[model samples]
Target: MVMTNFLQKRKSVRDFKNKEIARDSIEAIKNYIEEIEKETETVSFKFYENGSIIYNGLKGKAGYSGVMIEAPSYIALMKKDEEKESCLNTGYYLEKLNTQIVNLDLDSCWITLDNVDDETKKNLFGAEGTKVDYVVAFGYGVGKKLFTPETTSGRYTMDQIVFKDEIGNEISADELETTGLLDIFASVRFAPSHKNSQPWRFVMEDHNVVLYMEKSDEDSRSLVDMGVVMFYFEEMAKTIGRYGKWSVILEDQDKYLKVAKFSM
Candidate 1:
C-alpha cells in the first residue's frame, strides 16, 4: 500500500497466529533494520527470532498491567543513550520499520517494557549493545490480511489538537483547508499513541509548523509519542506538496513539551 493509505489504515494486532515469521521474511526485516540504522545515529533494531523467550520473560512484568502480547517474533529498539533524542528516534524509526512489516503481509503491536527493570531486560535479550526500551511483537494475524482489524480507537478533530499561532489559540478547519492541510491533519489522527492518549498538539505559523506533546510523567513514553506523530505529519505532508524534515526544538511550556519544528 502507499504511504498515506498505510498510515490511515494501520492497525495493531495483539493476537497473532501460532507461526514463526518465515526465514526469508526475517531476512527482509534485517535488511530494513540495517537501512534504518544508517538514517539515524541514536537507535538500531534487534530482531528476536524466537519470540517465546521474550514473551515468557516479559509476561506479568511488561506491557500494560504487565500483560504481554504474544506473537511469533519480536523486534526491539536499541538506543545508545537515554536522552530525549534517543527516545524520539526510537519511536520515529521503529514506526517507520513497522510500516515495512505491514507491507510484508504481517501485523505488529508495540509493547512497552518500562515496567521491566534494566537487569531483566538485559538478561532476557542479552547484554550486548542492545538497550531494549520497547519491543514490537509481529506475525500474521489470526485471519485474512485484507480485512480491517476491528478498532475501538478514536481521534481528536483538527481544532481540538491544533492551534493557529500558539497553544490555546485554536486553528479553524476552514483555515487549514485554505492552507491545503485539512485532509492531511485529519488522516494523521490515526497515528497510535500510548493507551491512545494521543498527547500530540500543533501550533501553526505562516511558514512553519511546531509540534508539542503533553508533559507526561518523567521517564514516560510521551517523547516517543512525539516522534511517532512527527513521522505521520511529515509523511502526510509529503503527500501534498510540502516537504521538510523535523528539527528538534526541545523546550518546556509548563505542561507541554516543545518537541520539534518543520518548515513548510
Candidate 2:
C-alpha cells in the first residue's frame, strides 16, 4: 500500500523549469548511474550533462509525437543488442533509475526515439547512440500551473488483468485479498508503461504469479513495458515480505505471451 501510494502520486512532468541541475546533484546522478548500471549489464546508461545538445538535436525529431520534453539534463538507455530480454531489462532498470531520480527531489519523463534513425542517433549521441532506444528527460518542474487542468491516465483493476491459473479464467478479488496479495496487485498496477497502455496480465497458479504481456499491434515496446512492471511488482512484493527473482519466460501463446514467472 505504501508503494502504491508512492506510485499513485508519481507523474511525468512535461513542463520543467528552465534551470540546470546543481553541480553536486549532477555528480550524484552520475554516481547513481554507476551504482545502477552494475546490477544489469544488458542495459547501458549514458548521462548527457549538457542537455542542450541532446534537446536541440532531438527536438521536433523524436519523443511521443514531435514534441520533446525540454529538461536541463537527460539519460539515455542503450541495449546490448536487439534481444527481447535486453528490451525487458532496459525497462526494468530505467524504472529503477527513475525511482532514484524521484528520490532526489527531481522529475522525469520517458522519451522514446522510435521516429529517429540510426545515423541521426550516432551523430547526436556518439557511436553508442545508435543503440539507444529510450532517453529520459529529468529536471525540476516549472511548478503546478494555475488555471490549468492536469490530465492523467486511467489504470485497470485486478479482475481485468489478473486471471485464475491461466490466461482466460477469472481470478476473484476475494482470492487475491485472502492470498495476502491484494496490496501487491493494487500497487503494481500503477507501474508506468508506454502511452499508459499497461498491456500486462498475471496468471496466479499454485501461489506463484506468472507474468504475461498482451501483444499490442500498435506498440513495439511492449517487452520494455513488461520489464517495467516486473520491477514494481517485485518492489511492492518485498514490502509485504514476499521475495523472488524473476525467471524470464518469453514464450508466446494463442491469447497472451508468457513473459516471466515469480515463484514466491
TM per candidate comes to 0.89, 0.91
lDDT of each: 0.82, 0.83
Off by over 4 Å in 2: 143-154
Model 1 local distance difference test score: 0.82
Q: Mind giving the per-residue lDDT tens digits that candidate 2 earns over 45-113?
A: 989988888999998897655887789999999889878899889888999889888878888888888
Give the count of colliding residue pairs in each prediction.
0, 0
Best prediction by lDDT: 2
How good is model 2 by TM-score?
Answer: 0.91
Off by over 4 Å in 1: 63-65, 128-130, 143-154
